[model samples]
Target: MKEINREVEAILRDMIEQRVRAMISGEATSNDLLGILLETNIRESQEGGIKNAMTTEDVIDECKLFYIAGHETTTVSLTWALILLSMHPEWQERAREEVLNLFGASKPDYDGLSQLKIVTMIMHEVMRLYPPVNFTERSAAAEVKLGEVTYPPGVHFLLPHIFLHRNPETWGPNANEFNPERFAQGVAKASVHGAFLPFSGGPRVCIGQNFAMLEAKLCLARILQHFRFELSPAYAHAPYTLVTMQPQFGAQIIIRRC
Candidate 1:
């Protein structure tokens, strides 16, 4: 792990250096996240002195977090959503019909995307079933108690959200089943409080949660507008977690133009 992290840091350091040089030379202006971050850093340095700005190491760390949390998590989520949609054609059809009703072959716009109730429900259900991150850990800020247990400050707790998501007691009899209708009312009323946490919960929840959902909805709508898809004969059902939950074997899907 140390070796892999060192290698990744080296690559990120090189990228950061190149971007810094570009900014210094005025060769190009970037509008991407990295660019915005660099711009902010420069502004801070100019206004509040160098100590107020993030160091290159800080930028590299932020980039690493965003790359993994933003990219990997969403990619795996889309894959799972597609795989689940293939398995449940009825739901897929419903989602497609909803998308068509709103956009009607036009590119999905911001307002239209918000009106995609079925697609949103489908994405929520997919996350519930195969959440990108299987578990998240948190350290107690101060001494805290839950039920009969008490923990000291800095006590780390591993919350296995996968198990919680599928709890029959919390989600009812069909908890393990694919039922997006459960979320029709909305996430708050979907299940008990803290029951459906694909992106985790609380103030420290995944920062990209909203953006990721929006991206997923838009991507799914576009795909539905263009194609009908299903699981291939060779597809296997084996979800495992490396960093995020993904199919142990690749997801093989058969897609045809709409």
Candidate 2:
């Protein structure tokens, strides 16, 4: 684990340096995505950090997080949403209709996205089924007690979201099924407390949750406006969790111009 962490850190550091050089030389065309994040990290590091004074290493770490947290998770969410939408044409039509009604010929903006309740429900449902971070671990820093179990300090606990999300007791009989209507009114009205946490919960909740949702909604709306899609016969429904929950095989879909 230590070696893997080191390797990951080194790779991100190199990427950051390369991007910085590109920006400095005016070789980069845009600073919209990673270039912006890299620049922000550099500026913060130069500003002598925040309250705690972040070191160069800390800035590098933040850059790594900005990449993983900002990009990878949203990519998985979007892929799964597209796969589900393709598999269910009725739902796709409904979502596309909602997007069209809300935005029409205009591009989606922050205010327009806020009115996309159906798209929001669909995204939430996708997260429930294919949460990007499938599992997480927490180590007890001190002795702790739950309903029935007591753990000593230094004990590690694993929470597998895949199982938890599909638990019948919490989500009812249709737990394993694809039913966005379940979240039509939003998660607060859909499930028990702590039952649905695709982005985890509490103070440690994902920082980029809002950004990811907006990105997914915008991308889906754009795709729907340009194309109609359906699951290709070649698509296999096998999903696995490596670093994230992804279809073991590529998601194959049939697309026709709209």
Candidate 3:
């Protein structure tokens, strides 16, 4: 396990370095986020004070973080989405119909994907039921008080998102049930008690949320366009956590061409 971890870390480090090298060699186009980050770092280093300027190591660290966090969260969420859609064939058919109606036989574009209300609703429901990250930890820089609880400096707080998401007080009696209609009026109307936090919430929310959503929508749309799927007979329902909540065994689904 340790050897595997080291190999993973080494691969990640190489990827970060490759991007940095690409940016330096005038090979990477200044269009994507990586290019933008590289440009910003260079501009800041040239124009700002030492405190404001970011070192090469800082850029690599940020890139590695963005790559891993963005990739992991989205992959887990999409996997769960597929599993849920397979279990609920009716919702899956409805989503496919919606996608077909919007972009039939054509590539799903940004504007069209944004207009997919039903698909968005299903995605929200899946996220609520199976959030990628089970919990989040935040350390207090200084002493802080919230209501009756007082926290000292260097205190680490564990905010369990799954607990809040599944709470009956927050989501009514059908909190644990798969009901996309809860988000019918939109996310704002879904939870009035600040309960719906699939992306963590507030300023500390996942930074690549928009990117992840777009990625999921496009992948799901493409999947729906060409295939119909359902859980396999051998499939087991076991969700466990490592860095993220994932299928402990595996998510086995049978797919057929639509």
Candidate 4:
């Protein structure tokens, strides 16, 4: 945990340093997303314990959270999405077609991303099969009953997303299959309330879900528009859960200019 925190700190420091340099060099005059986050962090620090707050240290800590939450989560999602697309050519083709239809011969933007229903479906399916945060734990504050099972206070429940996602009863017969069409009508039509939660549910739901999805849509649209991708001959399909679910053997794909 210390190592992880240190790594996050380093990344955050680097990002801030880069932005500072850009400002100094006149490469960037106006504040961007990072600047907004820094300002928010300063305000939070002042509210907490700092007197005349808004220190550089406070900004660095906030940037660290962004680096860990924003960068890590999005990278895991994109990696899994690419792997799933490579493994399933038909789905990839459908996604490409949908992207092209929505923003043909043009650059992808926020409005164009909102129109990518098929791509969104494909992304949802990919996240379902290979959720970044595969498992989470919750401790009961009081005695609780779940159907026939009863748990005493202080009991811990493990929610394994990978297992729940593959449940045959909840999903159809081919629950393990990579079928994006299952989400054609959205998640409400795909599974029950607690059945599908890649970004989790309720109050603790991911704060950057919208940002992540938009980033993914833009990246995918740009990649598909410029290149056709396929699984490499030597590619291996082995997924394992660490901090996030990632390909154990790295993602190898054949990319051809479109």
For model 4, name the residue pairs that clash: none
**Residue runs of model 2 more than 4 Å from their true location after superposition:** 1-52
Candidate 2: what lDDT? 0.84
> Would you list the clashing residue pairs of candidate 3?
none
Provide the TM-score for each candidate, comma-separated: 0.93, 0.83, 0.90, 0.81
lDDT of 4 by residue, 1-258 (tens): 899878877877787777656655657435667776655554566688676556666777666666667887778888888878988888888888988888887998888899899889988898899988788779999999999999999999889998889999999789999999899888898987579878888888889888888998898889888788888888788898777788888888888998
**Model 1 off-target regions past 4 Å?**
1-4, 141-143
> Candidate 3 has what TM-score?
0.90
Model 1 error, position 41 (Å): 1.2
> After superposing candidate 3, which stretches have Cα over 4 Å from the reference?
1-30
**TM-score rank order:** 1, 3, 2, 4
| Candidate number of the best lDDT | 1
Q: Write model 1 residue lDDT over 1-258, tens digit each, in one string.
A: 999999999999998999989998887767899999998898889999988999999999999999999999999999999999999999999999999999999999998888889999999999999999999898999999999999999999999988999999989999999999999999989868678888887887898898999999999999999999999999989999999999999999999999
Stretches of candidate 4 exceeding 4 Å from the true structure: 1-34, 41-61, 140-155
Better of 3 and 4 by TM-score: 3
lDDT of 3 by residue, 176-236 (tens): 9998889999988997777777788778888888878889989999999999999998989
Worst 10 residues of 3 by lDDT: 55-64
Superposed on all Cα atoms, the candidates' RMSDs to the truth, in angstroms, are 1.8, 3.8, 2.3, 4.1
Put down candidate 2 lDDT per residue, 126-206, tens digits, no spaces: 999899999888999999998899999999998988788899998999998899999977788887867888888888899
